[model samples]
Target: MGKSKEKRLCKQVKHDVLEEDLDGYKKLVVNPTHLCVKCGRVCNDPGLLCEPEPID
Candidate 1:
Protein backbone atom coordinates (compact mmCIF):
# COMPACT_ATOMS: atom_id res chain seq x y z
CA MET A 1 0.00 0.00 0.00
CA GLY A 2 1.15 3.55 -0.67
CA LYS A 3 1.93 5.92 2.18
CA SER A 4 -1.27 7.86 2.60
CA LYS A 5 -0.72 11.50 3.56
CA GLU A 6 -4.27 11.77 4.89
CA LYS A 7 -3.78 8.85 7.25
CA ARG A 8 -4.08 11.14 10.26
CA LEU A 9 -6.25 13.81 8.74
CA CYS A 10 -9.71 14.49 10.13
CA LYS A 11 -12.80 15.03 8.00
CA GLN A 12 -14.49 17.74 10.06
CA VAL A 13 -14.37 21.48 10.72
CA LYS A 14 -11.39 23.16 12.38
CA HIS A 15 -10.33 26.64 11.26
CA ASP A 16 -12.22 29.92 10.88
CA VAL A 17 -13.40 29.48 7.30
CA LEU A 18 -14.80 32.43 5.43
CA GLU A 19 -18.54 32.59 4.71
CA GLU A 20 -18.02 32.35 0.97
CA ASP A 21 -16.08 29.89 -1.15
CA LEU A 22 -14.17 31.63 -3.92
CA ASP A 23 -13.25 30.12 -7.23
CA GLY A 24 -9.97 28.21 -6.89
CA TYR A 25 -9.94 29.69 -3.37
CA LYS A 26 -8.23 32.73 -4.95
CA LYS A 27 -10.34 35.30 -3.12
CA LEU A 28 -9.66 33.29 0.01
CA VAL A 29 -5.97 33.76 -0.94
CA VAL A 30 -5.18 30.29 0.36
CA ASN A 31 -6.59 26.89 1.20
CA PRO A 32 -8.89 28.23 3.87
CA THR A 33 -11.78 26.30 5.41
CA HIS A 34 -14.24 26.72 8.25
CA LEU A 35 -13.33 23.37 9.67
CA CYS A 36 -9.82 22.21 10.36
CA VAL A 37 -9.95 19.09 8.22
CA LYS A 38 -6.95 17.75 10.04
CA CYS A 39 -7.99 17.98 13.68
CA GLY A 40 -11.70 18.80 13.40
CA ARG A 41 -11.26 21.76 15.75
CA VAL A 42 -14.13 24.01 14.77
CA CYS A 43 -14.55 27.62 15.81
CA ASN A 44 -17.87 27.24 17.56
CA ASP A 45 -18.14 30.98 18.14
CA PRO A 46 -16.41 32.37 15.13
CA GLY A 47 -17.08 36.09 15.04
CA LEU A 48 -17.57 38.21 11.93
CA LEU A 49 -14.04 39.39 11.50
CA CYS A 50 -13.67 41.64 8.51
CA GLU A 51 -12.61 45.11 7.43
CA PRO A 52 -14.92 47.59 5.70
CA GLU A 53 -13.39 48.34 2.33
CA PRO A 54 -14.53 51.07 -0.07
CA ILE A 55 -17.27 49.66 -2.27
CA ASP A 56 -16.69 50.99 -5.74
Candidate 2:
Protein backbone atom coordinates (compact mmCIF):
# COMPACT_ATOMS: atom_id res chain seq x y z
CA MET A 1 0.00 0.00 0.00
CA GLY A 2 1.19 3.52 -0.81
CA LYS A 3 0.74 6.42 1.51
CA SER A 4 -1.13 9.42 0.16
CA LYS A 5 0.57 12.76 0.25
CA GLU A 6 -0.89 15.15 2.78
CA LYS A 7 -2.57 18.19 1.33
CA ARG A 8 -1.04 21.37 2.60
CA LEU A 9 -3.24 24.35 3.33
CA CYS A 10 -2.41 27.81 2.00
CA LYS A 11 -0.79 28.69 5.29
CA GLN A 12 1.81 25.99 4.66
CA VAL A 13 2.97 27.83 1.57
CA LYS A 14 5.60 30.47 2.22
CA HIS A 15 4.65 34.00 1.20
CA ASP A 16 6.93 37.02 1.04
CA VAL A 17 5.11 38.65 3.93
CA LEU A 18 6.28 38.13 7.50
CA GLU A 19 3.22 38.96 9.61
CA GLU A 20 0.29 37.75 7.50
CA ASP A 21 -0.37 34.18 6.34
CA LEU A 22 -3.14 31.59 6.25
CA ASP A 23 -4.72 28.58 4.55
CA GLY A 24 -6.45 30.46 1.72
CA TYR A 25 -3.65 31.96 -0.36
CA LYS A 26 -3.33 28.67 -2.25
CA LYS A 27 -6.20 29.92 -4.45
CA LEU A 28 -3.94 32.60 -5.87
CA VAL A 29 -2.66 30.15 -8.44
CA VAL A 30 -3.95 31.27 -11.82
CA ASN A 31 -5.46 28.63 -14.05
CA PRO A 32 -3.12 26.99 -16.62
CA THR A 33 -0.16 29.04 -15.31
CA HIS A 34 -0.40 28.44 -11.55
CA LEU A 35 0.76 31.96 -10.79
CA CYS A 36 -0.10 33.91 -7.69
CA VAL A 37 -2.40 36.91 -8.22
CA LYS A 38 -1.25 38.82 -5.17
CA CYS A 39 2.34 38.63 -6.39
CA GLY A 40 1.20 39.79 -9.81
CA ARG A 41 2.95 38.37 -12.93
CA VAL A 42 6.56 39.17 -12.21
CA CYS A 43 7.16 37.36 -8.95
CA ASN A 44 8.11 33.69 -9.24
CA ASP A 45 9.43 32.68 -5.84
CA PRO A 46 6.65 31.41 -3.61
CA GLY A 47 8.49 32.94 -0.69
CA LEU A 48 8.13 36.26 -2.48
CA LEU A 49 4.41 35.97 -3.11
CA CYS A 50 2.40 38.84 -1.69
CA GLU A 51 0.66 38.37 1.64
CA PRO A 52 -2.59 36.47 1.42
CA GLU A 53 -5.79 38.53 1.60
CA PRO A 54 -6.66 39.21 5.20
CA ILE A 55 -9.35 37.08 6.84
CA ASP A 56 -11.99 38.75 9.03
TM-score of each: 0.18, 0.20
List the global CA lDDT of all models: 0.28, 0.34
Query: Clash pairs of candidate 2?
Result: 11-22
Regions more than 4 Å wrong, model 1: 1-33, 44-56
What's model 2's lDDT at 1?
32
For TM-score, the strongest prediction is: 2
lDDT by residue (14-45, candidate 1, tens digit) is 22223222341243223333444334333222
Error of model 2, residue 33, in angstroms: 8.0
Model 2 weakest 10-residue run by lDDT: 3-12
Error of 2 at 45 (Å): 1.7
Per-residue CA lDDT of model 2 for 1-56, tens digit only, reads 33223422233344342234322233434232323455433222344334433222
